[model samples]
Structures are given as C-alpha cells and as structure tokens.
Target: MNCESIRNQFSSYLDGELASEQSRRVERHLSDCQGCHAQWLELQQLDARLQGLAVPQDLESRIVAAVGAETDAEQQAQPAPPPRGYRKQVVAAVIGLAAMIGLLAVWLRPNMPPVDVPPPLAAVVVRSIGNVQVRAPDAEGWSDVDGPHHALPRGSRIKTPQRGGCEVETATDAQLRLDANTEMVVHGSSHMQVLRGQVWCQAAPQQPLTLGTRPPADTAAVPDVFVCPAASEMQVRVDQHQAAEVGTEPVRKAWQLPLLALPGSDQGELSSLVETLLANVGHSKMQFMNADQIRALGPRGAIPLLMYVREPSSSQQPAVRRQAMQLAAEVADDTALTMLDELLADPDPQIRRLAEATVERLSVGSAR
Candidate 1:
C-alpha cells in the first residue's frame, strides 16, 4: 500500500477491516515505510488528545444559535411563498412517506444503533406455588457450595431458587460471598435468615452476618443472624437472644429459608441480589423507561434510569432488563412493542444493542 492509500485506510486497518491480501500488502509497506509509520503514530496520538478534550459548557446553546442564524438568513433571502399547488403537496406527501419508511428501516436495522424502541415490563411471577433452591457458579472450580452445609472458598456458588437468579460475591475476609438466587434475612444480632437462595459465607466470629430487609424495603421482619465463631462453629437464629440453630448439618440446611417469614418482602431483596449478581457478572444497569414507568420509578422511587439506548456502555445496564424483555415477548401486545421502542431510545450503546437483540428474539419466538 502506498502512503496515501495507507493513510486513507488507516482507520479501517486499525479496526482490522483489511482482507488477507490487503493486510499482507500493508504489512509489507509498513516494514519499509518509516514515514507512513510515523504518520500512523501521529494519528494515534491525535486521537488520544482529542479524546481528552471534555465537552465545553454551553456547546448545545452555541450550536443552536449558529444553526438558527443560518436558517433565519436563508429564510430572509427567500422570496414570498408561492401559491399552494397540488404537485407540491403530492411531492411533500411522497417525501414524508419516504422519511417514515427510512425511519422504519433504521428501527429494523440490526447493525444500526437502536432508537425509539420501548423497554419491556418487569416480570411478575403470578404464583410461585412450588418452591426450590439451587446454586450458581455451576461451572466447576468456580463454586463453593458442594452440598447444603458445606462452604467453599471465595467465589463459590450459592444456590438460588430461580433459573435466572443472582449469585453471591465475596469481597472481604469477614463478609461472606453471596451468589445468585440467594436470600438471607437478619433476625437480629444472633441469627440470620436464608429464605430460599444461596450464599457463600466465611465462618468467622468478628465477621457476624445478618440477612433481613435492606435498603429500598420499607420494613423488615425479625432479623436473622448467622454466627460462625472462630472455632468454625455456626448457628442461625431470629436474634442473638435465641439460638436459631447450631452445628454444621442443621445450620447448612436452615440457611435455605433465611427469609421464610418475609416471603413477599424478599422480592426487593431478590431484586437487589439480582442487581448485585449482574454487576459481578460484568454488567451495568441503565435506565430505559417508557412514559408511564418513568413517572412512577421517578416520582415514587425517586430514581430515574432514562437514557438513549445506542450510547456505548448500555450493556452494563441492569441485566434484569433482559429478563423483562423476554417477559414482554411472552406477553406480546401493543403496549410491549411501544415499551420496546421507547427503550430503543436509551442512550447507552450496549443497552441499545441488547434492545435490538431482544426485539429480534421476541419476534422470532412469536413467529414460531
């Protein structure tokens, strides 16, 4: 590749777009072309510098003023409006239809960023009549839960009841690791509750742990505390005043129902646990809401997660959104489609990509 050609294709080459033949040619040229190499390095440095420049204040206002001035000047230069003509109306209608089709194409394009797609509604399990508990970190060498009573080293899987549940993560020595689908209720200073999920806890005295209603929960049941002394001994109880349990086997089994008393309250806890698991699973939560939920999650919850869906880092948004999207497909309706479209406007790029994928998934599933 010559200098000019290489320069023109520099971005594509940097992005690994060149085919084998072109790639070999570029490699050969780079080996002998010090000047081109220098230019490439300069371009990379320029990119870095440009990235470092922060958005200036009032950028929107400045751009708006410039665009408005241009438009106003153009309008002033134009003569008076011509009389209404059927031909002009027909042309305008055709243009409008074309624009609408173009927008639909953009919405349907998988490669393009998502825009105007609505988010799915949160899933509601009508009745979880039967109960079950399981653990995650199912991948061998990743989980610590071997059985009901055993605790593994850090990063071990705690069992969760639901299929798409959360996992326990251990961050420090005293604090035990929590895995997906795990729930714990703090009975008091003495005993901790495990309602029907998995948790990986270190048996340490100075590190007493309790599971109960946490943040976002209006009330908590009698807190349950899990005690593991330095002796590697463990106990579960509603409070320090009572012995919820003692010994390895019983304690392990009892951990399953830490939140037994607060089943409904466990929803918020479960949601929080899911959020935690998603973060550990290398995801971030972005807020994409329709016109309605935006008001509720905002006014009531005092939190807003609204954004454009096509911006980078949307993937890091809450994994729960994915679950919601699936649920929307199961309950396909105009409302669901509208919600998906609204989410398409989410500012997060990863979210936008996911929203698009979810739309396709729902569509395919419906067709089947």
Candidate 2:
C-alpha cells in the first residue's frame, strides 16, 4: 500500500480497527517509511497525553454553583415588573425561572448511580416446526407457538419437542437454528444459554455472536465455539452438549438443519494444531494449548477441530465427549455424519441423544 493510503488509515490502525490484511500492510509500510512512522509516534504520544489528564473532582458542582449564582444576580439586576398591565408577562417569566431552577437542580443532583439498561431484542423466530412452544417470563406454562414467524420476547424459554425445530433471525441478520428436543433461554439479542440440546448459528458480517453453557464436570470436555465475525470482537464459552431421555417413543418429525455461511479461509497451521491436540487427547496440557490456539485462530479454525472432537472413543473423557457433541452442533459439518451414525448405537442414552441432534444439525449444514 502507498504511504498516502497507510496514512489515511493511521487512526483505525492505532485503534486496532483495521482488518488483519490492512493492518499488516500498514505495519510493513511504516517499517520502511520514516516520515509515516514519525507521524504515528506523534499520534500515539498525543493520545497518551490526553488519557493521562484527569478531570477536577468538583468540576461539575463548581460549574453548577457558578451558573446558579450568575442567574440569581441577573434576576436581581433586572428592573422590577412594570405595572399591573404587565402582570401576565411577569407570571410567565416567573414560571420560566422556576422551570429553569428545577432543571438545574436535577442536573446538579449528587451521588446518582447509573442505571442498567437491558439488551434490546436481537432476534425473532422466523420459522417453526412441529411441537415448538414458548414460555414467557410471566407465564405459568408453555404455550404452543405455531406459525411461520413470531417475535420471541426477551427472557422467554423455548423448547422443541421430538421431531421439532425452529429458526431465528438476529438483529444483525444472522440465523440461529435449534435442533429437536432442545431447550434454551434467550439472554439478550446476541447472547443465549443452551440449557440442553444443540444450536447452529451463522454470524453476520462484523457482528460476532456468543452462546454460553455451564462448565463441564470433566476437564477433558471440548470448549464452546466462540464465533467472532469478520473484523469483530472475540467471545468465548465452554461446550456442554449432554442430552436428556424423554421416552421410548420414536421421533417422527423430521426437520432440516439451517444452511451455514461460514467465512472461506483455509485452516492451514490451525488444522495441524488441532490434529496434534487430538492425537494427545488425554493430555491436559495439550488440550489447554489446543484450546488457546483455536481461540486465537478464530472462526476459520472451527471445523476440523470440532470434527476431531466429535469422533467417539470408548476411552475418551466424558468432558471431551460432551464438548465434541456441542462443537459438532455448532459447526454442523456433513463429514461428521458417519461418527454421529455410530453414536446412535452407543449404550449411553445421553450420548445417543446428543449424536442424534448433531446429525440433524450437520445434515442441514451439509444440505446448504
């Protein structure tokens, strides 16, 4: 990139707002261009100086008191009300003065604590399949939520019965798909906790999404997919995809998984790291290192790493098994179909259920 182009993006670069490619280019240019580098240093110094300056502790109160005194003096200096004929004008002026004083008092009120604002509604149910229900925060029981589209209130709990699923569109236009026999509580527009079952999500450009779950009892569990969208902030969580048994009845409803539109980037070194981590599966140190690297690698590093986690092993840690299920659901790759199929015959009921959900998710993702 030219010096002019690098200079134009200096502010964004300083704020870490530039894309990786652009940031790299700017850094390379700065290394070879002395003038631009000097300019960058000046900007950094100026920012540091500004941040170092502190506001006077009583500045607000002092300003308010000074303004109030000035207002009172001005009023006193003004000529007295002319006569009875000007009575209406005098009354209006008095009312205005009182209103001003009231406003000033409010503005100068001390020790007022900040109020917390709840996150705004970030998504709405855009589609629903068999036996989906919602329980509002104020409701005592689940109400059947039947339709093509509906607005889900914040703090509501949603459930999909056997053979059921649904899709939600987030404010950023990202899509989240829930698998059958799943339950989750919506925390905010961009955040939610998966109580049980799996969720498939695709983030909008520059709008990262987060899904939180309880920490696993087993230390070997696979961590959750903390999806950071293109040029966005990072969010992390642990994966816990354990399933619950409802009954002996067979699932009759069939729902397709939502199509995922992930960023197109080769895994490269990340894939190698994931392979090494899997080869050393039971080693805690290796697992920790792998988790750190995957997080640093971002969304592009999700797929095969998660696929490795999904592979079932009788000697594998419970935490690792659970993590694989959850990450599989998050990534939803078709390649996991064989492993998921094998899990169907596993003795553990919870693993079977988790595998079933993951299969559905992968099917949908693969279809797309």
Candidate 3:
C-alpha cells in the first residue's frame, strides 16, 4: 500500500481492529518502510502521554455540589419545608447552614434548575459481556452496535432497542436491548449483572453510565463482574475468573468500534490485548464457545455490525452503516431476523427500510 493508504489505516492497525488482509498489508509495508514504522512509534508515545493524564478528583466533587445546590435552591423556593417533629427541627437547624450555602450556590450558578434524574436513568452507557448481547427497540427497530464494543466512554450511545426485548438504556438517551435467549451483564450505575440471560437498560443523562467497580465476591464461581461508577452513570462488565474447564480465561472479549477508534500506539495491540482478555476469560468458559459461539460473544466478529443499524448517532455515517449491514447479514440469526421485522414499524422510515432489506438477506441465509 502507498503512504496515504497506510496512514489511513494506521489507527486501525495500531488498534488491531484491521481485517486480516489489511493487517497483513500494513504489517508488510511497515516492515519495508522505515518512515511508517517511525510514525507508528510516535503514535505510541502520544497514546502513552494521553493515557497518563489523570482525571481531576475535584470533578466528582464539583458535580455533586452542583446537584446539591440545585436541589437546595428548589427547596428554598418553596414556602415551607417538609413537616417534622421537634427533634427533626433540631436536626434540620444543624444542617440548615449547609442547605443555605447550597441555596446560595444554586442562585449563583448559571445552569439553573437541575433535574432529579434517577441514577439508573442517568446511565450514559450500557455494555453487555459474556455469552450474548442484544437490545430492545426504540421508535425504530433493533439498532446495530458497531464502532467499538467499548465505545461508551467515547460518547457513542446505543439507541433504544425494540420493546419486549432485553435492552439497556443510558442517560444520554442511548439504549442497549438484548434479544431473547441472549445472556449478558449491564455494569455501571443502575448496575445489572446478567448471568446466562439477556437484559435491556435505559441510561440517564449528566453522568453517562459505565462499568464501575464490582462488588467483592467469590469471582472464581461467578466469572463475570459488572461495575457501576460512583455517580458516573457508566456501566462496565468485567470478565471474572469462574471455575471451569475453559482454563483460567474468561469466555470471550468484544469491544465497541469506537474504543478501537482510539488514537495511539498499538491500537491494534491494545485491542488485541482486550480481545485476548475476552478470549482468555478465565475458567472453563473458553471451551464452551465454538468458532461461531466465539464470534457471537462480542463485537469482534459480526455482532457490532448488526447492532449499528439502529444507532442514531452522527458518528455512524450512511456509508459506514451500509457496510456494517452487509457484514451483519453475513452472520444474521433468527433473533436478528425477528428484531428487524419488528423494526419495520419504526418511526424512522429510513431505519425501518434498512432493517427490512437486511432482514430479508439474513432470512434467506437462514432458509438455506
């Protein structure tokens, strides 16, 4: 490949998200071209530098204070506080100073009223791991998740899946709906851990849900951990070590395309590492997944492409959607077919049409 072509795929190559053929071409060129190799080195350094940047501790505190202030202001705007006994009044007096301070903050702040959004509803991202992943429906049909399995932190939201399906929604109005017979976990606040089952979720805004920390337990038996960030609204599913013949590895790994879209050195290597982690999901889980089973485990194979169809994000361009549809059709299943059929009644005619066409191709393969 030429320099431009090689450069275009540099990100994918670094992320290990490239197709086998593309990976080979880039690897070959990098071997022969010192310039591109040097470019790779620079990219690596840049990633390291970026990753080292830490999120400020004050961020959480500031956000909490902001919310508290907003609440206090609303309370003061009212004539009377909730009724309480004499002892309660005494307690209120002690805390009244802090409330007054919060009230002042609310008056001074520019954002104005702060809505009391629920924690689970505040989830901004929902990720499914282990066994299977699916979504419920929105106005459209079932959406496809492409980009990256780990794309939540990137602000890419999953549109709500169809009704009656196991889907998860995020605070950003994104959704993660699982099809029937699929099993997975939804981590982050509104924390849900799916053990050999399918689930759907809706996230709240302000704090996008992501996989937070997991509750301590005998991980060797569970083999999967889902964490809810403290007030962050992000859900994450971590593969845990379960007692099984699949060795000490988790069943599989799947990432969103956006995570692979990260800029850095060895984007491919890092993706590969995540993939290896998913593939090596500890215990005997690995042995249970056949080739097809492995592919269905995450976005690594065809699942991401399938999930992207319903994604109503600016990032998912038309051409990208078309390409993803083609890929999904190649591995379409009955669940996908049913989901597409339901999507035909979607409010977005365009999405409905796309689902119709894609489902037809998928069903044809099923017939054969």
Candidate 4:
C-alpha cells in the first residue's frame, strides 16, 4: 500500500480490523518506511497514556434504571445492522458524557478532573423527580439531571424548581427530603444548609440528632425535624456523638448572588477565550474538558457562542452540539428567550423540542 492510503487505515490496523492481504501490505510498508514506523509508534504511545479507566458502577446502574423507567415498553428491532460509524458515536457519547456533568457530580467522569483521583463522595442522590439541576462546587451554571445521579461531592448545590423535588442520603446516614422550590447545599458528611423551601430531616438513627430551624419547626419527632420553612431557613447537623442543631438565621451565600464580572472588567479576553474553545470543541482531548469552561463563562457571554455552536452552520460533532443545547437550557433565562425562540425553527426535532421547553421555563421564571 502507498504511504497515504496505508496511513488512512492506521486506526483500523491498530484495532486488528484490516483484511489479511491489506494488513500484510501495510505491515510491509511500515517495516520499509522509517517515517511510517515512527508515526505508528507515536500512536501507540498516545493510546497507552489512557490507563486505569474508572467508570462509577453506581452511576451506571442509575443511568440504566433511569432509562428503564422512562421507556414504557420494550420493542425488539430486527432491522439491518447500523453503519459501522454509528457505534463509534454512541460509545464516544456514553463515555464522554460524564465530562459533559455540564451529565453529572464532583462533574467528570465531567464532575471529575481530567486526571484520575478518588473523589470524596459526600452524599448519595437517592431520588430525583420532575425537572432537577445540580451545580458542582464553583460551577457557574446548573447541569440538567439526566437519569439517577449518585455520588455528590461535598459543597455541590442541588435545586428543585417549583415543579420538582429530590432526596439525598448523606455519608452521616442522615436523610433529607427537599420539597419543590427548595435548594440545598451539602456541607460534607454531617452538615447541610437549606437555603429556601421546606425540607424534612431524618437524622442518623445511631446519633443523638440535634436539629435546628431558622424560625422554628416541630422537633417533637425525635431524630426527625420537620422543617416548616415559613420565612426561616433550615440547618441539619448530625454529629456522631453530639446533638444535631437545626435552625435558620441568615442564609450565607444563597444561590442567587451578584453575577460575576467576566474575568474582571475586561470583556476582550473573555470573548477571545470563548472563540478558542468553540473552534476546538471537537478536538479529542478538548471536547471532554470544554463543557466546564463554557459553563464558567456565564450565559450572557456565551449566548452568542451557544447560538453559533448549536446552529446547523457550525462544525461541531453531534454530541458536542447536543451538549451545547443542553447547556443552553441549563443557563437559559428571560434574556435568552430570543435566541431560544429562534431555535424553535431548528431542523432537528430534538433541538426544537428542547428550545420550546426552555422558552416555557424562562417565561415561567420571568413571571415569578
């Protein structure tokens, strides 16, 4: 085989996918061509860098159960096999979606760092109902909760809008159930802060739980503090040996704060960075890391970039474009209604549906 043609088949060759005759020809060329051999070696070295892959098993079951729950019936397909390229796309998306927690926690497999490190699990997301979103500690925007979410890192914030509610079991064995219009921040194993809305706390059975409330709730039920969130915040503290204190005073760092200025008073650098990440959104390594960066840029600055990326004119991959649209929904507000309204005409039915939903949500939020 000629150098050009043989190089095109390198991935297939590495995957042991070449036909016998073609594989022999490619092998002959690699042995004789010094440059080709070096290139192949580089590819192998890069492949070896990815070692010790860890996929969270709890995360996997949650995704499976969530999908199983959503589908009302099972239909067997006996159609022709899909194109070879189709499977590649599906695998890429499924594996990389974690980096994309812009699908999950802590953000990578997106809640996690690009490197391998055991993230401290702060709590388990036991239940998620209706529309729910979570923001990783220091994340700039909410990530739509798809499927069952597990292993929330400390300091992550979960919110249930007027329509949704969620439940979590902390490492301390305490259980907290949030009602609609509630937002909560988990402060490690034993501490929790409910910024707003009503929440019922079930202290660890083993601990002498002390529960406190901002205003006051009936703590008559031992180990159970039914927080009547009437103008007061709730605190659930479960100590191994001490009484749990639950009370509401002033809320520190409530979810809504002044929006951050774009990396100081300058917009020039921020604009340039946005363009850079957009152009490289499909790069092998960059695609997995870009979601967090885009979210951190804030919705206002990303409004134009988001429109460009999700537009049919852009060159992003299908997965990347889908991620962008999902992100648009996360940060969407009344200010984004115009762009989302325009998206209503998108040729992709999925995008159109998402845009319609986002618009409705923005309208509702704006009214409030």
TM-scores, all models, native as reference? 0.20, 0.35, 0.21, 0.28
lDDT, candidate 3, 249-334, per-residue tens: 22122333322334432377455555344323411232343445644654344444444454444123655555454445555566
Computed on alpha carbons, the lDDT of every model, listed in order, comes to 0.40, 0.57, 0.44, 0.57
By summed lDDT, the worst window of 10 consecutive residues in model 1 runs over 118-127
Q: Which wins on TM-score, candidate 1 or candidate 3? A: 3
Question: How far is 77's C-alpha from truth in model 3 (Å)?
Answer: 45
The parts of candidate 3 lying over 4 Å away from their true place are 1-230, 233-302, 345-350, 358-368
Indicate whether candidate 3 or candidate 4 has the larger TM-score. Answer: 4
Cα miss at 140, model 2 (Å)?
A: 2.8
lDDT of 3 at 293: 60
Per-residue CA lDDT of candidate 4, range 88-155, in tens?
56555655676445323433354544754443566777766668778887679988776554667766
lDDT tens digits, residue span 1-368, model 2: 77788889978866668887776577556545657766875665455434434445565455556655665676688865345545445445555565556556645887767544332354677777678898776679998886655666567788888787777776656666777777877754555667676565555664345454544556665423233343333322123434222211122112232212112222453444444455334233225655555455443344444445444432367666555445445544565576568768776677688778878776766788
Supply candidate 1's per-residue lDDT for 246. 30
Q: List residue ranges in candidate 4 displaced over 4 A.
A: 1-119, 208-368
User: How many clashes in each candidate?
Assistant: 77, 4, 95, 23
